[model samples]
Target chain A: MIPVCFILIILHAYVNKIAIYDSFVSGAKEGIITVFKIFPTLLGLMLSVAILRESGALNFISKIFLPLAKIIGYPCEAIPLTFMRLVSSSASTSLILDIFKNHGPDSFIGRFVSIMMSCTETIFYTISVYFMSVKITKIRYTLAGALISNFFGIISSLIITKIFFHY
Target chain B: MLSYLWVSMILFGILFSAFSGNLSGITSAVINSSRESVEICLTMLGVLSVWAGMMKIAENSGLIKSLTKKIMPFLKFLFPKLDKESQSIKYIATNIIANMLGLNWAATPAGLKAMQELQKINIDKKIASREMCMFMILNMSSLQIISINIIAFRSQYKSQNPSETIGPGLIATSISTLSAIIFTKVFEKIYFKDGDQK
Candidate 1:
């Protein structure tokens, strides 16, 4: 990736000399400012997670899905992972790793949610991002569209599990 | 009415299951999760701060503006009605740039700003203008250069080869973006045919 970017850099410099230097630096600069501006959101997500883990809230939360989770062959604890996919995909990715380590990827939850991940768009987050940027007050329709897709994602996951893992 | 039906079915399922405990737990998790989002977003500070700086320097240095100029021809074909001087156009370009880098967080402001800009040119207040609609569609089905979410998911799951998903994601999102473009065009032509019947 680095080599490719550098090559693009060199090529741009050769042809669009001024653009190459200016935009690259400016884009990187904006990236820096954005990072600082959003610092609180990142900190809040991590700290809340730490509290959940320490408070046993994670397990308590998982218990809600226990009955249906068993029927679907998923671990109830995977529920938090599902929500985590919204806040931070990386964190959810780590959670997926733990699930595999704790129960193996072959387990119901891993395979099920994995497929759901592929099918569903990040609904609420996308809306919030757009809202914040555009400062739009209305979000009803967008939310509806995303939630509706969530059903599609759930169905797709179930189908995927049946095709890939059912005995 | 149709939406009403959908909402009712969901509510009925929730009530009938009486697994309120399960739901309550899920709700709490969701609440808890929402609360934690700030920290996780913050934890990414180290990496994003540098990248954001790089992006800003590129902007201040005129990298982004030039790129927008370069892409203007192609963008014109995509959104002809948009005025070049409009803030919406600038926002759209910036948002798209952020998206291309998989910087969804940064893209939000650009996207929102674009919408506000679009509102200025809205015609009869009947429905969304073509440019506004297209912007929303493109933003929603954005073709990402790197799907940070997917990469993160791969990491969380502890795959021996987490990066393998990159190829598949690129292909999948490419298809989705193309589809979004095609669909938007079709919907517009079908729904907003320009001239009145003879």
Candidate 2:
């Protein structure tokens, strides 16, 4: 799919007589600048998240929410990944890998985490970095809205996975 | 809001470790995680640069403009306050297309550029406009037709059918994206009743 898009883009550029190389160079430069612009926020966010993980704060929160998971028929083992989904994709990915490693990929919990991981975004990370780049200080209700939708994403993932996997 | 989240995470980490007698773990994490953050940025650097370059070629070829025109009515409904001829609309459309195709590496740069363009026309320099908020919500929800990463992960783990999750993932993501758009509009109505619309 990506290759098809790339080919179509190249064909379009050729047909339109566009200066593809120079445009690419300029855009690449802008991309580098954007990375640098958001680097500091990414650093601070990752560090805090690492501390949270290493300190077992996430586990503590997961434990606190165990009853809620039980009520919804969600796997207790997958709770950490769902909690981490809000903060860091890398952390959640690692947790998903761990779940797959421990329970095997074909297991119900394994499939559930894989589906859930793809359904949601790293909300806090995206919000901070995106807003920081544009220098938007007052976010208003964006956070609340994103979090509420994320809640739906999580719930729907569980329900959908349960219905499909039937475990 | 971000500041509060950042500080609370750090505080909770410190306080929890102290109570659990694992302060040393936090110390090591603070040092090692900073390096991990740099590594993550470096990985993103390669992907973003390549995809951003491709996006530029697309823009130069007028693909983005044409795509924006095709989706203009939907964009108009979503961003009612934005001008019909705004350049940000093109960028937003490009970002959405990239995201839908599971080209997130390409999507971030366009998304950032779109936000920058939106910022240019913003009445208040520091505060986000309604359109900006709506765009961010859409980007965050990210309705995916194909979740390439998950498929790759499943295949790597030797799933019998790695693509099995695609159907469920699409349904779940669509629901989430719709809910996000609705919640954004609802919040705007409830919270910004008397504020400047533009």
Each model's lDDT? 0.55, 0.87
Report the lDDT tens digits of candidate 1 across residue range A1-167. 43454454455455554555555455555545555554443343344443334344444556776887778655466677765654445566677677767764445665555555554455434544444343344432334334443444455456555655553
Residue pairs in steric clash, candidate 2? none
Model 1 TM-score on chain A: 0.68
Best by lDDT: 2
Q: Please give the distance, in angstroms, between residue B11's alpha carbon in candidate 2 and its true position after superposition.
A: 0.8
Model 2: per-residue lDDT, tens digit, B64-169?
A: 8998899898888899877878889888999988888888888899889889999998888888888889998888885667878878888888989988988988
Going through the candidates in order, their DockQ values are 0.16, 0.78
Model 1 spans with C-alpha error above 4 angstroms:
A1-95, A98-120, A132-167, B1-19, B22-34, B37-55, B123-128, B148-160, B195-198
Indicate the TM-score of model 1.
0.57
Q: At residue B145, what lDDT does model 1 achieve?
A: 62
